[model samples]
Target: MTSGGRRAVTVLSGFLGSGKTTLLRRYLAGHGAGVAVIINEFGAIGVDHHLVRMVEEQSVLLQGGCVCCTRREDLVRTLRDLLDQENSGKLPPISQVVIETSGIADPVPVLFTLGTDPVLQHQFAPAAVVVTLDALNAAAQIERQPEVRKQIIAADWVVVTKTDLAPFEAVSRCRMRVRQLNPTARITVSRLGDGSDALAPTRGAVRGLPPEAPAAPHSEVQSTALGFNAPLDWPAFGVWLGMLLQARGPDVLRIKGLLDIGDAGPVVMNVAQHVVHPPEHLAAWPADADGSYLVFITRGIDPARIADSLETFQRAGGRADLSVRELA
Candidate 1:
């Protein structure tokens, strides 16, 4: 379950031939009991939805246009229909909802729909955006299609597919690019469709990295992780973060991390677009964890600018000793 009692929705996205269907089939075979699947395709007919329907009956198809683009309203209507079915006892109770976007789609619009639609927002919560990356072709794919960057930036987890087929150097390059593109996204590799567990929903996920000046924003978006060693003054840091998000929320795709606020337990922060989920405070830090870490996935913004602004605001607010570094 997510923050509230609402059912969670997971967005499955990837480039063409990135193994989204393989992972989805496996996920359904293992854990289809209370899940509703929606497959959107940009083809004339719904081949994948048909394939998925063979394994799971609780499935729907949105075809002919990209769900993240022209067919978004269809997505909204379909989601409402699913809820109506469950309400009328036409379908089993839905514990979760998963939407698989067309390989060419940009996930940001769908995320905006989820965060903005009042009816959907109340009934369904954002679980995670899980993206499949083809290790063999990821480096070239990123170079060829700019949309691929947005998919990675919006992802909460990236599953590197076809690692066995990819040479060690190819896989290595893919991993490096994934990290450089989305420093906070949890990445895992899989062969033969196993590792679907990484696609599952997580609660209050957080990660951070040491600071470094990134080259100019790669593509239209870029990501980096920022870490600070000292306990930050809550008000000072909060104000700085709030101002940044307020000013650039649209370009700031996602931000999440754990903060060390001295007296309090580690605090978990999450922000997507303009929406800031209530912060979660854990009882204690994990034994190996230390300091505060934040990951930022952004567009049209430089990591150095963000880091500089953060330090400036923090100092202006009188928290001078807070050390800030960007993850390499």
Candidate 2:
């Protein structure tokens, strides 16, 4: 264990079934001892812990469907344990920490907690928010899962996973979609989470003014989400979203909502730049609400124009099957 260098933490995140675990396993094999891993899994206790515990020297586990809402305290406790071990000489000084978040976990809260949490912030240095996207399933999942969209939008570096299985044509299309969602992210395509360099600064992890400040103001590009109380016709709303994405996906970083439409009591909707998936029907709203609610997040874009497009969608008769090209 080394004491002169600062400890780095990397958030390995992605949509469900993305190869995050495999990536961590690979990274750990290459790097020697003195690194700690914390794995968080969704629901019914994490199986990843039992499987990987044998391989790694030091590791902790947190299991729950939603870590942000329920198990935040667990993270603090585990981190403290690692630090204490480091101090006692029971373990080698931990040089780096890598957290594999549950598929549905939002990386923002994790990063914020890492920086703002008084106890941990003082001890650890922010490293990178590394996200893995399945070259085969990422586009469809991004469209169907709001959680997935947030993961991509919040990433500093994105690894296009499963590239070997995808043809160049398809991989190129996925990369294009990712660019529209995150214009500034460093993207690398990998078959097994391989990328150049061992260290990279994560987005949002670095706080404070840079050497050169941006010429534009924050208002020039703002992201906000709006919610709806009632559900509109699914077919009609689909048409509205279709037209909206086609017209402004480049400017719209993300969209997420749960709709109450017809028999689709609870429909999960997500949209990133060029990719769209059929709405996922969740178990039902928390209550028996009869209306649909929607939330949209956009940046450097005007909402009034989007409103006008929605109006046009309703006027032209809803076309649920509408599809369009990805906007640049």
State the local distance difference test value for candidate 1.
Answer: 0.73
Give lDDT tens digits, candidate 2, residues 1-328.
1122557777788877777766776677666366687777642333333122211112222353223322255567778787887799877777777777888877755655555457787787556677888889876887788787778776667888888888888788777766656544567788755752332323222211111112322343443333343334667777777766667766665554455565634675544333342355655453433344333446766655555455456446553333221111
My TM-score estimates for the predictions, one after another, are 0.78, 0.55
lDDT of each candidate versus the true structure = 0.73, 0.58
- The clash count for each model shown is 5, 4
Model 1 Cα shift for residue 130 (angstroms)? 0.9
The top-ranked prediction according to TM-score is: 1
State candidate 1's TM-score.
Answer: 0.78
lDDT of 2: 0.58
